[model samples]
Target chain A: MLNVEKIRADFDVLNPESPAKAPVYLDSACMSLKPRQVVEAMNDYYANYPACAGRSSHKLGDKVTKKVKKARELVTEFINAKSDDEIIFTRNTTEGINLLANSLGLQKGDIVLISDKEHNSNLVPWLRLRDKIGIVVRICPTNEDGTFNLDNFSQLVSGAKLVSVVHTSNLDGVTNPAKEIIKIAHQAGALVALDAAQSIPHKKVDVRDLDVDFLAFSGHKMLGPTGTGVFYGKLELLEKLSPFLVGGDTVESTSYDSYKMLPAPEKFEAGLQDYAGIIGLGEAVKYLSQFDFKYIAEHEFKLNAYITNELQKIPKIKIIGPEDPKLRSGIVNFYIDGTDMHKFAVMLDEMAGIEIRSGRHCVHSWFENKKIYNSARVSLYLYNMMEDAETFITNLKKILEIL
Target chain B: MPCIVALIVFGIMGIFSASHRALAEEAFGCVFKRITFRPCNTGFAEKIKGKILSKLLVRSAFLAKMVNRHYEILSWIFFILMVGSTIWVGRGVYNFYVYGSCNGLNESGFCAFDPSGENNKVTSVGDDSSCGITQQSEQNVTLENINLSGFPAINTGSKDTVVFVGCYACDYSRRAYPDIKKLVENKKSNYIFAHYPAKGDTMFLGEAGYCVQKEYPEKFWEFNDYLFTADKDYVLNKSNLDEILSKFGFDVKKISDCANSAETKTAVQDQTTELKKTNLYGTPTIFINGKAFVGPKPYRVYRSAINKFIFF
Candidate 1:
């Protein structure tokens, strides 16, 4: 097991003994706690080399260029991608998904399959493509219990050009069977893209292991700086996809009349990048790499189980996802009966210093279908401690009683 | 190579909402997808140079080459200037945002006497004595609660009401701050902080006291201690509120709402009403046993007044 106390020391906000009560930060599955190292990396970039990279020949520019190169390499290794060439930095997972939606040649008659539990990022891009180009978007069904239904996926994926699904959901924290889905999709002669925004932070997601052709995830969700994200595609597939954003760095050379486009990653990245965020992302990956996935996953499982068991003891509170804590990953969504969820959330933060998320969890489509408006979500991270879960459960009882 | 990577970093870092959106999402994600992806355009200089070189090349290729050769030097200067300007402008913008004016001087059309700023200071303006309209409203306040919530009276006392009507940021207020704080620390008298915000931001700063008291009812003094002792020109905003509230681990958004609430505004109005009752001449005005201290005075004098109120 990771020495969580030592790891917690790296995050100033999570230290329980600090003068200020460290908030029971259960919102990490949305955006993880950035280690001190990640922030310092970004601050160093701003303080030292606040210069334009790639375009400038100055010393600062060269330093920035080198930092960006190192970051790309780190990301390539982090995802275990084929090469750094296959890794493209994006604004966030949404952009990565959008890039694929616009670039991957899915014509009017072609089909794209997605899980019903897709966040708007994975869902909207395909829907837009379906409307803009003549393509059909098919939803693969999840069981009544919110687990993926493999039979329905096989039925809907016939003649589909691509199957893109969220690796893990922010809604209920159930990780979809991506490897199995990928294998099945590949058998159906379809490409696969995994929105790993929630999964990549918690577990080891090797592209080689899953045989995933495309993977999209955000840095902020993984203890990196915000606005930094990664889009990983197989080199050949990336080469085949046309450039979605065409300007600036996307080209090797250009004239008024003609232009020669650059390689896969370069062709996609058009605007000035967030080097600080990118470098910080590299630093963040290095920070998380200290603890193996096995340790991290186990820590989360224990905390989730503890919190879930405590919530089950409460009267009239319903856990939204799978009853099994392991299936819920680190996310536990529940709503107490006979209370306004929004007020419950406010009281939790104000009264108990327990910072949690209460809303539809951005899976409003699924919520709307069920007619459930809001739920209080306690999402954990690697830095979260057993004591934090105890505080959450204890505070929860106090809030419930007071409300 | 430069173009591809140039923007990669800048685009990610410069977009304000990148981290802001992340904060909102990590907090609970967004209510709506307001700004999903806004990439920072990093190669602006290159684009301008490209345009300039293209224009110059049409005229004379030799001159364009000559200019291109020295572009590295020009870029170095540009980079330095941009960084310096961002820092410079950032400070000015922050000060103006916090202090309600440039250079962080609170500007009330009526200038009360300030002992802190020298004549040369950019923040100082208007005669310090000019703001006073000779004491009006003769009905003296009893040794009890006023119309507004200042600091809740320490204890219901037969002791005289010491009404303090001043801006915490004003020159004389800075002088009186520590001494009054010393008295407040010693629990000298029943102090009523009747605020007359001579500067712009202090009104909201006063409102913050009442707002904060709503959440942590007992920490009004602790909050007041922070207000009186911090940097003379430090301003309050949402993020600054985040720092202060997080210290106590309170909900920043809730406190911020109360600070900006209509009820808080009513509390400030009551403060103004209380200020009117004090017959205020200038800031650092102390009303003890129906007598007044006009400007900053000795700690012993305040001690004597408290001594008189208790013993007389």
Candidate 2:
């Protein structure tokens, strides 16, 4: 077993309190707290080679280029992608999704199918495309508890030129079986883009094994700096796709009227990228790689199970996604019987310093379809322990009693 | 929904009837019909109350019953108060328009000084805590040239450059790192590093990087990286500091001796003196050209400031 306490020690910000004490942060789903190593790696970039990457032939530029290349390699290895050439640095999962939406060259008549449970990042791009260019966008319906229905997906993917779905829901960590979904989508003669924002950080994601055409995730969610993300596409597909953003380091040669664009990743990069963030993401990958993902998966599962068991005792609380904690993986989203969920979250926050997010979780379409206005979400990470879960439940009991 | 529409129609009729009690047909019928029809019919307001209070039935039977009984009455009372207040507001508005003052007060500042509704908005001054600008420590003093040894600046050509004097182990300095890095990447200005050790740990970081720089020129940047980017905060006493420096293939004894030596200690003191000379109240006291660009602001701020200095 990985020494979780020792792992907790790796994050100074997570120290119960620095001066006195602080709240138990259960909002890692939003963005993770970085370990010392990740922060330091970024700091090193600024301190040593604050130079821009690829644009210059100077020593500093060479150093930056090397660091960024290594980062790309690290990201490639981390996802177990077929090639480093396939990875393109982006701002976040949202940016990655936008890149695909704009660059995929989907026409007016083409159809794109996504799960009903996708986060706004995955859903909005398709919606925008539908509105902008008259492309047809359909949502694959899920089971009552928000688990993806393979049958519904099979039905939805038949006409879709591309099927973009979230690998795991941010609202409730119910992981869509990506491999099966990809296989089905491929059989239907459709491409697959898995929004791995919620899955990439917490568990092992072998992109090759899944045979996903494109995958997107935020570096910030994976213990890296914010404004850093990855968009992994099959090399052949990337080469064929058009660039979304043009100019600056995205070209090889140019005429007054026309320009010859750079290949694949460079063409997509467009401008001076987040070099420090990319480099820091590499360190974050290294930091996360130190742990066996089975351990990561197990630690999260147990913690989620503990929270779920306690929540089940409170009859008024309704878990929103899957009934089983194992299905949730690391996130437990729920709403209390009659009370306003936002008020409940505020009370939990102000009263006990227990930090949990409350909202429709940027999946208003899913919420609108389910007729669920909002929910309070408690998300866990590898750094989270049994005690954090226990404290949350204990505080929750007090809150419920007070109510 | 029809019930709400009917209530709205009745309320308007009642208000019109109350104003013109002399009218025998619609106005008279509306006032009598509204109050009488509303209480008996137990309108949309009552329906909404019942729907709402029914939720409390699971938690407390007594409270739920009380709420169910009183909810309609409460709703009625609220409606009356709203009407009364509206009339009062209308009268006040009439008075103000004719006399240029509200609430029957002749003074100019009366309504002006009446606290704005913005004051009562949920995200009022009191609620700024949710997304507050952290209090910035600022200084308007002219700063001196800070001495830096760790890493060479990109451009030292013209005096048109940025010398960011800061410590690595600082929380605030970490915030400024990305901004500073972005600034360096965007502008062609010379970027220089000057160490102003705030804490003991920072002092050790300074010494460690400096020692590594002194020994191996090529590895200095790597050592600097170890200090800043590697962690949130570093605990640099003797053992771990030695372990970190030694990992970089530096002679541990020489670096340790270099740290305690009068030279390095005096260097830190000299750096502190330069910091004092600059009137630096914070980390990342940035100077564009020779002008101390004040505030830990965005790249845009530096852009305008740098342009003014260069072009002028």
Candidate 3:
């Protein structure tokens, strides 16, 4: 069992006894609030050895280089990757997916499979490839309640060069059967890349167990610094992929006409990197590793269950995902038919200092398909407690009565 | 509709705050869209409404719900009120510029620009708190059927007439005398100085003024000015009056005899009756071309009241 009160003490913004008003943060899905440990780790890098990595030969340079390598090793261990060389630090999940979109070497008429409700990070990059390189883009439709449909995905996986889909939906919070999806995609000779932006924070994602060819997740969404993300791939597959962005640090030697590029991660990571953010991300992973994934999952489910049960009692709310709270994980997305969710979200902030995500949640295609404009989403994390959930429900009830 | 009100309210507040400046810019965009017959799709109005409703929700959900239901109608009502008050304020500023009083000439009321209504203050006619007389309302002040021929006169040949009824001992009248004297000399209008004792211990100056005007007509204006500008404590000394009469080249004994005569005393009494017929309720009441101004007006107000003069 997670001691949420003890956990909340690690986040300065969640301190209830402070003179300043503390927010009831329920928007962890959009961006989780950073713990003080992550912030101090970032501050430590900037305050002490603020230097470039992998290039300089001085003492500060060696310190930075070692810290960055350790961060890469931490990420590798976190995802159960085979080697540290397989990890490439990018800006965010969007950048990681963009790197794959431009580097995957898919030719014209090559099919790329995606779910019907993928975030724009996963969806738009494929759409751009379809427009630029004539790659065929196919969408595997989900069930009516927005759960991933395995038989429907199987029907679409044939003749596909790559099956890239969201491992967990940011819009609905349903974790797809990635192990099953990878097993089917591999038998059909299609490589699989999972957009794990919404998955890794709540539960365990072992790349070796699932045998995923590629996986990407952002640091900001998992209590790390912004502009830090990880892209993981198997060594052989990463070596086969073309470098998307190459510059100074990506090369081993250079001539006027030709240059030898570094291997895998280095060739993929161009120019100077976000060293402080990477170091902070390593600290975030270290902090998260102390807790068992089972506890984190259970804590999230308990909060979501309370919110979902209360929300279901409301008259006009239409929850966007499956009926069961366990399937939806920490996320509870719903909207009243005529309520403006932008105003709704702001009212939540105004009334009780409760913060939540509103609007399309970057899944515009799903909202457009269903012809529903937007929804308010409350995404819980390990730091949240029943009191926070109760405050949210009380405020929401007041808002609904008034608005 | 709320955007219009928001633009004005936030536009003024924007001058002092950066956050409000952003809202003001949003409201500007909303207003621009609204004026061109397009809907204000920026959601600025809804955002402000939500903020207001959220505050109301904490105190009373029922009240918040009522306000939310009638928000559009309430916005229209507030918009109309904002426009109406803006015009009213605009008119008040214009009145303050032209008449020296925000409410209008000689009307004393609470004005934001002049909160104390200092521009409309006057030495009351018969309502000196120490005098035990009931204060009369200023609304009754008028200039009906009052004969000005009996008062001390200057530039009598000019068409534009300026009649000033004041007392030497009153501070408001003393403050107004110099400006009126300059305007009469500059505009070359017929100027009349009527002595009405709005305070006690000033009745003797009225008798002295009548005697001086009759005996030393040419020196009367300069001597009258000396009385107004002199220290009130010095002018109240009866000996100081005889010395000033001698200094103005009037025989002190002859002026004193004329001032103390039964005929002069009766004439001063008749002058007071004539002054009362004009219905003046305060000292320093000036009539320029028959328009009565009943306070120590700014020179601009006095100048603006002259029909033949070009006003700034």
Candidate 4:
């Protein structure tokens, strides 16, 4: 089991004994709070050896190159990829999705399949590709309970060139069956890509085990620095794809008219990278490796189950996903019939410093399709205690009574 | 509605703060959208409401609920109040420029700009004085039909008249006299000097002024200038007054003889009675082009009264 109290001590923001009340941060699914270790790792790079990696042969440069290589290796191990060369550093999940959308060499009339509940980061890139290249984009609808409908997805993947979808719906935290979906898609001869931004933080996502052809997740979502993400591909698959953004270190040699490109990861990484952020991401992975995913999942589910039960007691509250808290994972998304969810979220913030995500959670297409305006989402993490859930429920009930 | 108020407030506050400037820009966009009859869904109002309710909710959830329920109505109320106060401040600024008091001529009320009411202060006429003025009515105070024939006068032929009724010994008048002198000399108007003893044992100075004007009319202005600018102790000393008269090329014996006469005393008293007809309430009362300025004014006030566009 995870020692949550000791884990809380690692984050300064969770200092409960301070003069001011520490924020009951239930918005971890949006962006996780960085621990002292992750911050210090970034500080070490900027303070001690701030230099460009792979370009310079000097001592500082060699130090940066070694640190960057170690970070890449950590990322590979984190995702259980075949080699470090399969991993490419990106700004965020959006950039990684965009790189795949542009570089995957899909031609006219080639079909790209997505789920009904994909985040805009996973949805927009494919839509843009469809628009620019005259390719067909298909939506595989979810079940009535907001869970992935594998039967419908299997039917939709028949002639699809690529099946890119969110692994876990950030909307309601209903994680899809990525392994089964990948097996079915591979049988249909369609490449499978999973947007694992939400899933990678709380659970173990081994790319080799799932055999997902492509996977992208953000560092900030997993307690790393913002503007850092990792996109992993099958080694041969990454090497075959063209570089979407080519510049500076992406090339081996350049002339006025022509240039020879570097290998997979280097060819994709353009200009100067976020070296500090990459180093911090590695430290974040090391920190996560200490904890077992089973315990993290259990801790989150305990809090989510409490929140879900308490929220169900409140009149007019309708949870977005399935009634079962086990399926919803860490996120407990709900909306009152006539109340403004944004205002409700803000009230929670003001009343008890309970921070939660509001609005569509970047899943506007789902909301628009369902005719739902917005929802307030409480996403739990391993560090969240039962006290945080009780406080959130108490404050929410007080707000409801007053209103 | 909140955007309108935010636009004005944040636009002004934007000058000193970059964060406010960003809000002002947002308010500008929101207000622009609102004026075009489109829905103001820019979230500016919601953001502001959230900020306000966030603070309010911590203090009192019931109050926050009430505010949230009536947010639009409250925004309208605030908008109206902001506009009303803006107009009120604008009028106060105008009145301060024109009348030297935020509450118009000679009215001593609280002015935000001149908080101490220094611009409207005067050396008051004492209760025991025989100037024969009992009531203070600023609106009723005017220069119509008041005879100016027997007063110490200069610039007689000019159309624009400046009548200054003051005391030589009064501090406010002494402070005002130099600026009034410069204005009168610069404008070259029909300037009349009426000496009413509003303070001190200065009735004798009034008789001395009457005598000096009568006996040596050519040096009367220079003599008046000297008395206003001179030390109060020196001006009050009878022998010093004679010495100054002498310096102005006046015969000390003749001026002293005229000053001591009962006739000259009656003349100064009659001058006071004539000045009182203008409802004279205080010392340093100046009339520029029929506009009765009841206290010592800045030179620009006097000059602007004449030109109505005095930049200097």
Candidate 5:
């Protein structure tokens, strides 16, 4: 089994001396706290070797350039990219999605299929493309328990120009069968882009094994620094795609009239990149790499199962999403009847120092479809233990009793 | 001889009589020359003399009135022209101060106050070749004729122009890039991304800078697509300091050499100090024509500022 206490100790933000007073931190789905190693890696970049990358022959610049390249390699290995050239660094998942929306050549009469459970980042761009290019965007509905309706998805993917699906729902933590989706989409002769923002951190993802055309994830959600993310595409596919940005480092040569661009990853990266954040992300991946995924998954599953069982005993509380532990990942989203989610979240924080996310969580369409205004979500990660879950359950019982 | 003397005497008497009657009419009824003059006391000869004298006096008075009226009209015209010219000059000065120079070359330019000197200088900070404003060392007194800090003034219906200047390597800039892209996509009246690399930030700054223009040509067009991108290092590092320019077509060598020269550096430093004195805080900071607004503000702030500028 993984050592929870050791992992918790690695994260300095969990200490009581921290200015924010060390929250219980059950909101890893939103953003994860940085480990000391990740923070130090970033600090070292600014403290000692800070320089512009890929420009100067100076020692500092060369060092930073190597660091950025190494970070790219790490990400390539992490995601099982065909080559390092297939990985492009971006600010976050939103940018990655926008990049695809701009470059993917969706024309009039083109059909783009998406799941109903997509985040706004995934939904809005396709919707915008639909408006711009007159493409048809078909939303595949999910089952009541938050699992993908494969039959409907299969029907929708046929004759579609593109199929974009969220690998895991951030709202409810139900994992979608992305492999099957990709297979069906390819059969239909459509390109596939996977929103792996939730999946990459919680579990192992091998893009080559999965054979998806494109995948996107953020650094912060996986214990990396903010303002860093990765976009992985198949090598051939990446080579086929045009870059969304163009500038100094991306081109091989240029004149007043025209210019020739570099291939793939370099072309996609157009400006001075965030070296420090990418370095921190490398450390974050390295730190996480030491953990046993099976143990991490099992530990979180046990605690989440315990929390779900206890929450069921409370009156007027209805859990949203799959009730089965096997169906859900580490998130538990629920609402108490007659209790405003915001008010409930505040009381939980004030009474117990338990941090949770409330409201639609940037997936307003899903909540709107369900006819629910908002819900409170308490997500768990590797740092959480059974004791923390017990403390939460006990506090929640008291809250329900008072209400 | 007796007749001639009598005639001259009669003429003087007639003139005096007319004058006296005119004064009496003004004093009583406010009408001149309407009161009846005493008929010539002599006969036909005395009547002709009185008529001739009366005609000459009336003609002279009418001429004097016309001259006075002519002078009044000329004075009114001159006053109107003076007021109009004053307003036109004031507006022209304000526009030059706020939006650089409107006139071609040397005749019109920014009116900047020299911080180091006692007197303000009307420096030609635009494309005035004859002004001897050639590129100089930073230590030189001549200033580069562009206001690098000002946002482009765009009037697109009700939208205000918000310019974001950043290098690709900056973490904050990366985070802000997508938002800037969205602003461009939304077609807000005035939104531009001005890509300026921080000193030594090289890598993606060039490539990403070009990609922004290549991928989103419409948005890039909106931004004028001119700034440092990843490939500018050659231009940035060139010894000649004039060869390396941005894909957006800004001469990087010229800008860099100018910026690094002692004079421009001093001016930049002084301008920074002045900005601090004015309490301007932080970048991603914005201005609606030099009126500062702190930023990373939401889309609403941009929209509101644009609305105010457009409507008012």
Candidate 6:
């Protein structure tokens, strides 16, 4: 029972004059459009109180520092972390994974376990580490529906130093059993990192409940600006890890001969940060907080279910991932028989003014596993309604008729 | 007394042995130098010193010249060789540390644009001027005219039926005098071309050749042919100009004499005034009976629009 029309109206981009004004925006999984509030918050920062955070002693600098600290606290609270000091702002989930892979001292004979359903960002770093540090990487098998197999994961995690897995699959919208995986890995005395890039926006993620050693998510996917993300780690473990990139802010004391590093979060952060994007992310989280997570989830589920049911009526259109509405979050990946996905997407835009994302969706390994070259994904958010879903299905049916 | 005498005798013998060894070392050095650098000896140096020096200097100079001539070339070759060796070492290091080079330099290199090669021809009609031509033929008559102004003019008989065709924004006028003369000479019966020099105006049409088929059902086809001829220059440069003109079977001379002709000056003045009045800024315009049409239209529309002013 989300007020989708009201929510849609709040975004300035949904206006008729906008080039990106799609009849139905079903690519929220790829990137969600920002609300006016989020944009305004960032604008306010730039217009009135623009300053570099934690650098100068002026009022503007203090103001920026205070706002940035509050943003960290907000993110920590949203993720249910024990302390705000554990949060480190990053460019995106990819940078977060890279930071961990490079910082952690993985030696020869050490093993890192991951799942096959991982995004390239998650998969490549581990592969790179295996090449650099002689660490072994074992990929846990996924089910046909792209869900994690707990038993298979357990077998893979044994004697491994790290078990990194995606909390939710971006390709299939199947939520992984990260909590159980974390529990088993902890029992086996292994560190766990969760790629929450797809999970953080759709549902409430309590890192404490999941008990993961590290969690990474991006701001753009959750209705904030690009080039902004958050990386969370347990404070104790964060203290032990070295910073991969060391620079001006990361050092506490320095000499020509040697340098002493700063503690934890500051040490991890090097160079200038995307302050505007971070401020926008903070505002995005606040804007999202207005809507109840349960209601938002239900709204998205209903729209996705409608699209799934309607798309199924057309012959030769096979939907990938979980068929059950309960298991699937908001994405519906499908392909029309004998129609090139890119061509189909283009025709839909030009002929019917409908927009969709058609590709491997960056989970190339999963698509390769399924032997699919590419797919068209219609991902719904809380602002989407049943009417939008109906229009999408109707247009899709028409497209099939012609193609 | 015996021990003291033995010590003194041993010390003297030791000193004598050391001195004798030193003298022997000096003698060996002197003998070695005498043997190696003796001026009288017919050894390698004494026998071929001049020849060797000449060859050595020549080789040294050649090597120095080679080094100077290809400093950057040698540096690049050395860098590439170094990189190759490092990669080989890296492969071995990878094998020893982290298994083999499964994904190491599998491909020859990264994709890059070839600077020496010509780029692919951009096919799409980019701007209004870029949609080079459209041809139209009508009722046993062909009207060939410049698609734009600033081109050579064509003389037309009053009774001739010339049908005008408009190109994309009057780009035809920008053609060189040779192209305009070719269009004029190729015309079978009357020439009708559009003139659009500014924005927000109708096209202007002119007449040339036998029967001026200005307004007719076949005007669109005739105009399209003329425009297509002009469009051939879109891709072809001067080297391929002969081939391009031969493709259309057009044999006309460059209009060098028209540079200071009264007709050319009058046409230019008329175009300038008309463009100023109508505010039509671009090319492929049409002027028939002092009326004009602007912008591009379908061949059928062109035929119907031209038919309003001329009869076949």
Runs of candidate 4 with Cα error greater than 4 angstroms are: B5-29, B36-39, B42-44, B58-61, B129-139, B157-159, B309-312
Q: Model 6, residue A247: displacement in angstroms?
A: 0.4
Worst 10 residues of 5 chain B by lDDT: B115-124
lDDT of 1 by residue, A1-403 (tens): 9888888888977765746788878899777888899999999999999877678889999999999989999888888998999999998999999999988877898999998888999988888887888699998879987888999998888898899999998988999998899999999999999999999999998998899999999999999999999999999999999987999878899888999999978898897889899999999988888879988889999999999999988878998879999998899999765433654555556655778877777787887787776678999998888988998887677544433
Model 6 per-residue lDDT at A278: 86
- For model 2, how does the per-residue alpha-carbon lDDT over A1-403 read when each residue is reduced to its tens digit? 7788898787877775657465677888998889989989999999998999988999999999999999999999999988888999999999999999999999998999988788989988998999999999998888988888999898879988999999989988999989999999999999999999999998899999999999999999999999999999999999989988999999998999999999989999988898999999999999999889888889889999989988998888999888899998799999865445665565556555678887788888877877776788999888887888988898677556544
TM-score (all chains, Cα) for each model: 0.57, 0.58, 0.85, 0.93, 0.56, 0.57
Please list the residue runs of candidate 5 whose C-alpha ends up more than 4 Å from where it truly belongs after superposition: A18-21, B1-312
For A1-403, candidate 6 gives per-residue lDDT tens digits of: 6888899888876766756555667788888889998899899899988999989889999988988888888898888999988999999998998888888788887999998878999999988888887899998998877777898888888999999888878888889988889999999989999999989999999999989999999999899888899989999999989889999788898999999998878898898777888888988888887778899889988888888788777768888877776677888888865444764565455545566788777788877876776788888787777877887777666545433
Please give the distance, in angstroms, between residue A81's alpha carbon in candidate 1 and its true position after superposition. 0.5
Deviation in Å, model 3, residue B186 alpha carbon: 7.8
lDDT of 1 by residue, B57-157 (tens): 54666776666668666656666666686687676555343332234322322222323322112212123443333223323434244453554556447
Per-residue alpha-carbon lDDT of candidate 5 for residues B1-312, written as tens digits (9 for 90 to 100)? 112223334444556797544433323331111234433222222122223323332355454334333534643565466558657767665433333222211222333321221111111121231111211211122112424442233334434555554443333344344555555556554554444433343322333334434444444443333232233444345352333335345545444555556655454444334333432222233444333332233343344444545323
Judging by TM-score, tell me the better candidate of 5 and 6.
Answer: 6
| Candidate topping DockQ | 3
- Docking quality category of candidate 3 according to DockQ thresholds: medium
DockQ of candidate 1 is 0.01
Candidate rank order under lDDT:
3, 4, 2, 1, 5, 6
Interface RMSD for each of the candidates: 29.4, 10.3, 1.1, 2.4, 52.1, 37.3
Candidate 1 lDDT at A391 equals 81
lDDT of 3 by residue, A76-149 (tens): 99999999999999999999899998998989999999999999999999999999989999999999999999
DockQ of all predictions against the true structure, Cα-based: 0.01, 0.01, 0.54, 0.38, 0.00, 0.01
Index of the highest-TM-score prediction: 4
Model 2 clashing residue pairs (backbone): A36-B231, A36-B232, A39-B229, A40-B229, A40-B230, A40-B231, A41-B229, A41-B230, A43-B229, A44-B229
